[model samples]
Target: MRKSDEAGTRPDVVRIWIALGLVIILIIAAAMMLVEADTQRDQQEQVASVISKLSTVRARLEGAINGNLLAITGLIVEISMNPEITQEEFSRYASVILAQKTEIRHVSAARNLVISHIYPLAGNKKALGLDYRQVKKQADAALRARDIGGIFVAGPINLGQGGRGFVARTPIYEFSESGVANQGRFWGLLSVVIDVDKLYGVAGLTSSNQTIEIAIRGQDSSGSDGAVFFGRPALFDSDRALLDVSLPHGSWQLAAA
Candidate 1:
């Protein structure tokens, strides 16, 4: 009851204060842990959402790329039937199909590795005479495309037509005049240039409300491996959602955060 006793450091009194302080500290710690648990849960949920979004975008974008591949298939077939496929005919077929695929900037055909026909050449005359094999940057890709004997893709390179994009190339093997089924020889290539920014925009990474960042790294269209054709390469190494894009002729790694 005395002031001295009230202020005294009695063993029991010290024990009482220590117990009370311990209770308060425990309560604060539990509350903080609960808040942290909620925060971690929310963060995990956001990650799940982003992963789901990435799956949807991957499917959609792959479909677009496949559609481009198919469009060129028709041209490839026609050219196979007649390696001398007319410029007028090629332009007609390509203009219509390329018009349907907004991601594709241009469609072209080459004979013996020479640019023989190109659709929408109005803005691409510079490409008409440009030989892929003649250029250092394009030669390896061109040769690889020819030897790989499949649909190849190259670039994230600047176009002679005046833009940055990717080119998808497929070797065209045509039958000889002898009309032998097995005697078909490698004729040339069918190339399509895809607008990178526009393609990613379609992939939903460029939307005004887009939040998830994405990147890709894989074999380029020219049969070169371990190249980051889209987005940042480091993102592939970072913690992100990874999806595999199965192309008609190849595969690529897709990463999203």
Candidate 2:
């Protein structure tokens, strides 16, 4: 081969190599795009799963709380009907209630802001004669129940009996001679103590640690404005799915990541 012929062939070889390099680059870019798409899809599916679990948790939590809170209405009715009811009757009624509701720690009746009667009075003996006016932590909730003439749920606060729990209270009014409830005549407060750990267990929040991260705020049913009572506090500050848990008298915030 002559020199001119060899130089022309070298240029042709270089051109072929450049074209092959461009094809390889294109293939790599396409593969990278497919991998990115798969990653995004997986992330989306995980997010959807977490959100579904969050909804279920919220429903279970609200149902357990509201249903248990409603159970104490019978005791409230009994006291309203007979303000002079003795300890024997109170104990009997409360015993029946506690037997049915496993989440309830104890039930008590506060006559004029002072706890007078409690059922299964073994561990809860200290709660007897407890004056709400004297306890700064519990005074507001106790007073609110009376003033509202309706139900008020308080805590995840330290209980007088022991441990942490929620206190559900409603104002009780005596019946008039005509059998009508005397709204103007204040009798006292009827309260039910709900165990927090047990309630969380019933709500499936504790078992969800493996799949989703959850946190609850709005202690005392104060909604999003209140402090976190469950899970990590940082969850509320990050990008999370927020839900409102409706309570007897207020709402709480549930956050999930």
Candidate 3:
């Protein structure tokens, strides 16, 4: 009788140990699963925050570009309407634009395809005997488009004589009895060359540690692949610096990290 009782007690003890071991394994697996879930959630939140900040930056940039274009167009129209604009008058107007170092980098006027431009750093020069239409295919196309009231951003063109820059063209127009006529009968194009660095600086993003990049791709040049205008070291090294935004008309993407 005593031996039977002892054997039964031993079997019970072994069963209890087996149950305890199974419970311990289950607890460890559950803990690991919870830790992984938390990590994944944190990563997702970080990505969402990044995307939100980038969108805000994009909106601000677009607004700034539009505002700048509008102001420039207004100035061109004012100049074109003045029948007696002397060199002094022209210089005064150019000075006003030049003063806006953050927005207007250069100002130019073209009459009968003759180009005259002024830069803040280098002062002013007339591209005498040179026809702007002869230089750029897009310029020719824009002239033909007959949308004189419209504004165009053009070029990574070589501004010969130690000059290399981009151009913005705003057509001048006047209303007539016959029809809506281009300012100067489409004889002239008001052109402005913007300093890319100054334009980017207006975003007030210089102090930011976050990655930022701006690209202007025209019908002319495609942007660089891996160049990050502003970014952290990790993003700068990554090939994914460029954003997936669609290029604007006559303009390219401006991205920030």
Specify the highest-lDDT model's number: 2
- Worst 10-residue stretch by lDDT in candidate 3? 214-223
lDDT of 2 by residue, 1-257 (tens): 99999999999999999999999999999999999999999888877787788999999998998888778878888898888888899999998888888999988899998998998789888788999899889899999888777888898888655678998988889876776654546888888989999999999888856478899999888998998999899988855478889987888898888
Q: lDDT of candidate 2? A: 0.87
Candidate 1 regions with alpha-carbon error over 4 angstroms: 1-11, 176-183, 213-237, 241-257
Winner on TM-score between 1 and 3 is 1
Ranking of candidates on TM-score, top first: 2, 1, 3
Model 2 TM-score, all chains together: 0.81
- Which is the better candidate, 2 or 3, if ranked by lDDT? 2
Please report how far candidate 2 places residue 107 from its true position, in Å.
Answer: 0.6
What do the candidate models score in CA lDDT, each in turn?
A: 0.79, 0.87, 0.55
Instruction: List model 1 lDDT by residue over 21-140, tens digit each.
Output: 999999999999999999999988987898898888888778878887887777777889987788899999998887889999988888888888988878876677778789898887
Worst 10-residue lDDT window for candidate 2 reads 176-185
* Clash-forming residue pairs, model 3: 172-183, 173-183, 211-231, 211-257, 212-230
Tens digits of per-residue lDDT for model 3, 1-257: 69999999998999999999999999999999999999989866755565566565556556666656655655665655763455566667777766654566566666655654333325355454457567665456347423635665555455544445545676665433454446245546677766554555555455366454433232322344423333343443433333342222343444434
Displacement of residue 86 (Cα, Å) in model 3 is 4.4
Question: Which pairs clash in the backbone of model 2?
Answer: none
